[model samples]
Target: MPVPSISTKKLIPSIAGKLALAGGSLVFGSWVLSDIVHLPGGGAGLLALGAGVWWVTRPSKPASFSEPSSLPGWIRRCEAVLAQFSELELSLGLDGLRSSREQELDRLKALHEPLSVGVVVSEGGTHPTTSELQIALEGVHSLELCIAKPLPVVADAWSWPQELEELDVILYGLPMPLRAADLLRLEQLPTDRPAWLLIRDSVHQSREARQEALSCQLPKQWCDRLLFWSGESADLRQGLLPVRSHFVQPSRSREITKQRLLTSLHRRWQAELEQLRRERFRSLLQRSQWIVAGVVIASPVPSVDLLAVAVVNGLMVKDMAQIWGCSWSSEVLQVVARQLGTAALGQGVVEWSGQALLGMAKLDGGTWLAAGLIQGLSAAYLTRVVGASMADWMALNAGVAEPDLEDLKRQAPLLVAKAAERERLDLPGFADQAKEWLKSQRYAGA
Candidate 1:
């Protein structure tokens, strides 16, 4: 089971912080207005507070996913993802995959050849060694055994080759008293195939010691499939069952391996596609935030500012949905965006941004220009938070036919917090960008 990107324990605190910020912003902004513009403090405060509530809770019209321009880089990347999926399905024996050009297809067909197993030996000691395992498997037919050591580590991680097309099931050996380095290495191995960790124990080792060794931390996936082995021929033979099962019925075994491979391939490819989409989204997010900032600066009315930001964020959500291959209608995407956006507002993303802007005012000196900049940056940061949370939600639910908007509403605050935490790590970068944007605006005015 996949763990959610954001945890529930932190969700409450995050939402509370946002609400506090929102309330604080309303009170403070209204006070500042009353003091500076000479209006009755209470009336200004109440008006601002009311306006804030109305804008945030107001229902809006649905927006659609925008069509891509002529082969934009993102479109090309999306096409690449589709192509990878098509090839994977074709390799898994799916029919009706029409290629545009009448090119050759032998390479794709060759991927379905007879099953091959690889025995990966750890560097150190092991009972019923590779030679012994080979002797135990003397009579097994139709299985090509490839013997190899774990790939050498480069820069503290396993350096995998471009393709592992030849091997299907990898029987990885692990000596007793599993080292952290070995576990780290295991983590880097390709998950797109059946991998079994063979824990080797000495025949002379005590049962207590063996139990202690077995108690070592292992991931849940590896824990169930763990094979305990000693030097005895019976132990080795029994331990080999999982690996041998792959070759039991050569044809049936082939299909099973292909199916397993396909499932893992889908997961790996989804991650790859998401990573690519994330890179593209950075630009989209930056652009949306700047636009939101500009609008907020031009017209600082709370409702109008939020509405403009919402429109920009709606378009962003549609593009993200399309990027993640979501088939949901624009209405569905907008519901998701609204859910996350509301959470962002409730959690005080805008308030936090306003506070940070005010903090900068200590050095920059107080002015209405600074106030506009503050609101603009707040809206921009709110967009960033909402966009990030939406991206997280869509990525987790990418392949699901129907995503539950209620579940998103429940998870929205935690997701926003998690995204905010990550985005804040790049605060200096954002600050620098804001500076450059401000400078550019000044130059444009001149």
Candidate 2:
């Protein structure tokens, strides 16, 4: 044989390996001998020796490949590739989105033009007063002020032509308190323009007088557009500038009042939007609570009801986030819901109310349907309390980070107690509403 190759397995053993092999053979032989001889102390000695040998000679674990210490190199590489692919896809999508947004912004810019304003003078006031307002407004060339006659007559006198439809704003000069008839006339006017209530009264008027002037109820739709201005503080000299120069002049002092008025209008619009959001939030929350209550009523399990409440509340938070124009993550809402649910449970309101309702129903010889109605109403009440608290929190911190859950938890019990008191007063009405809702559902299902 041409120089036989020596196998690695047949190579001479290291010191440690030799020791391990020798120890294993000796211990194994001793154990067998002790078993055959039945020696009293030898058996224990042999068992201990065998354990030592097994520990020493257990086939060197071969650097276990299955330990899960790290993912395979190929798997890591594949993951990196997938991540890059996802990033590439997102980048492409974002590019298209950015392009579309730029185009939309350009379109909006192209449509932007100067506002055309109309001034309406109250006949109850003198023509000199109308001339004074017209003279003051003459400074603003960017605005075309169409002077119309007083309240009741102005509705018929002012014509709304295709050109007039472009009127961006209206200023009403009211010297006296508005009557209901004046309000009706106002309602009849074109709604395309935002309206301002220019009170000709001096700002130095007594608090009582000012209060009396503003006491009249404006229509809900008009309240946002109807701003108040007083001529008491305006400089007489500053009021008579040419309308053409006013638009071009970059004088800060001249623009101050106009800027202030614009700022006030913006704030009013924001408030209106906020109010609408809250109303929508409340309605959605109530409907969600009702549905969740119905589901809980139908279900036999109590644990499932808790889960349902959490899920429903989480969804409500998402809706609220959209309403408030804030970013939301499901995780944050879940945390909030959990905290709220814990608070509700800790206060024992839900438990006590449910048990009390069930007891009353049982006393009245009630069926499952009666029990469900009680449970559903209780659920709706709890939801209302939670929703109210959430709305308050969102209103206070719109466009901010997610609310502090701990704060919500602390406030929830107190809110629930107050809600309970309110519900007690409104219970009769609520009962009738609930009854109608159930009937409608039954009819729909049928």
Candidate 3:
């Protein structure tokens, strides 16, 4: 007999699943021993077996260490964050971010009504092939095709031609024997829309020469988009199959093209917006870190530690979620804060900060003011790390309809580590900012 296989995307095995299985096995084994075999101490034996099974199958606690901001350490911290936060809370937080991000993405998609495509020839390239491609593309419904004469190849500051701006896609023609100027022109092209490079191989080259041309090291973005052209209509159509996939359809021609174009535009817009969002996230993180540091400086006792940080971070989380277009709810937000707080504690972030502050006091002649500065700085650093890791988490899981918190938890350590490593690179700048902040505080006090 042949065994049948089932495919599933749920690759990660959960503790809950293991526990359920163990419990069922225990129940069955107990019944067999106590009822059928008349075995002794069935209840006690069953309890022991259950305990053993749990001991073997239980999720391991996040590892701890005192390594100074290593990549692995950062990852461990991130994992601890996942373990610390409530699964439901983390899911909700990510879901909230995705909702807002997707909405903005959809809105941008709606605005992408690409009615035309532009064909621009490289400088010194012949116009015959450009005209031929234009004629061939005319049969493509709902896409206006326009041909442009060879433009200036070399410019220090390159900008897209005004005529090309309204076009949905660009089919750029390059002359045979590719020149450095042609590559430079390609490098200057806008990334907003798809740009296909049609290298007109008018004179047939040796197989080795053609291979070398195809293998010519262009940036990865332009690698697959460029191809050799024999100027044949069939070759042009076949080469453009992927681009045509965006809008070409026989049925409901107009509506299908628009809808497909919108979908394609949405993906591109999402990538562009993600870059913008990261910049905004960095600003938010910096502001939030300072807010945390300020709270630490103001508080005479540690009683205000978690509460003040929590309130500040809660608002930060809400802002981040909104930036990502995720829905916001206070209950889930609080849960996220609480869990991450627990992780920070479990991972010795609080202890590390306290020791650092004491060391600062020793170096600064034990002044209370100096101690406060160190404490605040340490708090600020912690905030920056946590906030950065959260941003990473949100980015990684953004479009997921139902985020698997357990899987995220398992990945936390690595994410936290990566964030820590990145933040570590900015340590000099971070320190300079802290010094400036300390000076301002001192001047204010004076």
Candidate 4:
């Protein structure tokens, strides 16, 4: 007779089936050993051996082909037990996540509105020529504009229309450079709304003449918003119309002028948005520096202080990266930490801080408390320097540059010095502000 061959596919399951039968037999044997066996120890030993064999040969379930109704009750029970551990009940699906993100984006978009613009023309001065006025009006489709003359009120007292007060931007239309008196009158108006000085004739003037006109015609404070608006090309227009009454059906030239103006205004608005973002980032950096300084002061060990500084600076860089729309990761943090560390070492900031603390100790009766305060101030100043340097680096790269140690090292000292000077001037106010901020944070946490 030929030897029978076992199929490999069926062999394991056959063995497993035998093992399961043996396990049941062992369980029954255990009962028999206790209840009936005359030689109990021998029966118990056999039971244990059977159990071991069953454990070693235990089988996995085969792929299910039966209908749900045919599934074993025990197998269904096992599935129920596994389902309890699954995250399907707790977590959202991909569609849910995408919807949440879109809602957040819509909320942010709702915070923005069209820029409000007001056009100011002095009563005594010449009005903007028809061409100049047209150019100024074309691109301002998004702004709400109103023509206002200097209110004939008391010197240093001018009332803006309620509408103008609500406006976000102002365009001052000047026929010629203002007299000194008019400049002073301009200064008395609210500084809250940003104003632009649109000089009608200065576009064709020499650079020196324009500067002289700005100096003589505008207040020193308003020089920042001054611009030459010679209506030579139809390209230089700004602000929005106050009423639809000012609107007219456009000729081809007028339409072209409107297009150019709109383009220019859009570019300006984008630039303003970028500037506002930078300012907000800088403010956050300043606050972070102050908080880190507080942490350093509270830390007992100098090494811990250093570590905190590095960590905080790294976080600040990460925030700046986000503001600039750059990806932040561990590698970015490491780059920032390395750059800050190198700058600190190169500038002898640590030694300077130590010396400064010692000096402050002498002045403040040499107490530990005084020393801690001084050290904190020093740390705060150094953090500001690091933040300022990082800000400059980000600005230079426009937030897209690869991490470079050499660039950071080179830029740090100059920014550090500037930051130090700023800190010196603003220390008292900053300290007060920081204290208030800390108290608010503590309250919030509580």
Clashing pairs for model 4 are 139-262
Q: Highest lDDT among the candidates is held by which one? A: 1
Question: Considering lDDT, which of the candidate structures 1 and 3 is the better prediction for this target?
Answer: 1
Model 3, poorest ten-residue lDDT window?
1-10
TM-score of 1: 0.65
- Assess candidate 2 and give its TM-score to the true structure: 0.42
- Report every candidate's CA lDDT: 0.65, 0.52, 0.60, 0.52
The lDDT of model 2 is 0.52
Report the error of model 4 at residue 44, Å: 99
Give the clash count for model 2: 1
True-structure lDDT of candidate 4: 0.52
Cα lDDT for residue 121, candidate 1:
54
Where does candidate 2 stray beyond 4 Å? 1-123, 129-145, 152-326, 342-365, 368-377, 391-398, 406-433, 436-446
lDDT of 4 at 196: 67
Cα-lDDT of candidate 3: 0.60
Give RMSD (Å) of candidate 3 vs. truth: 13.0
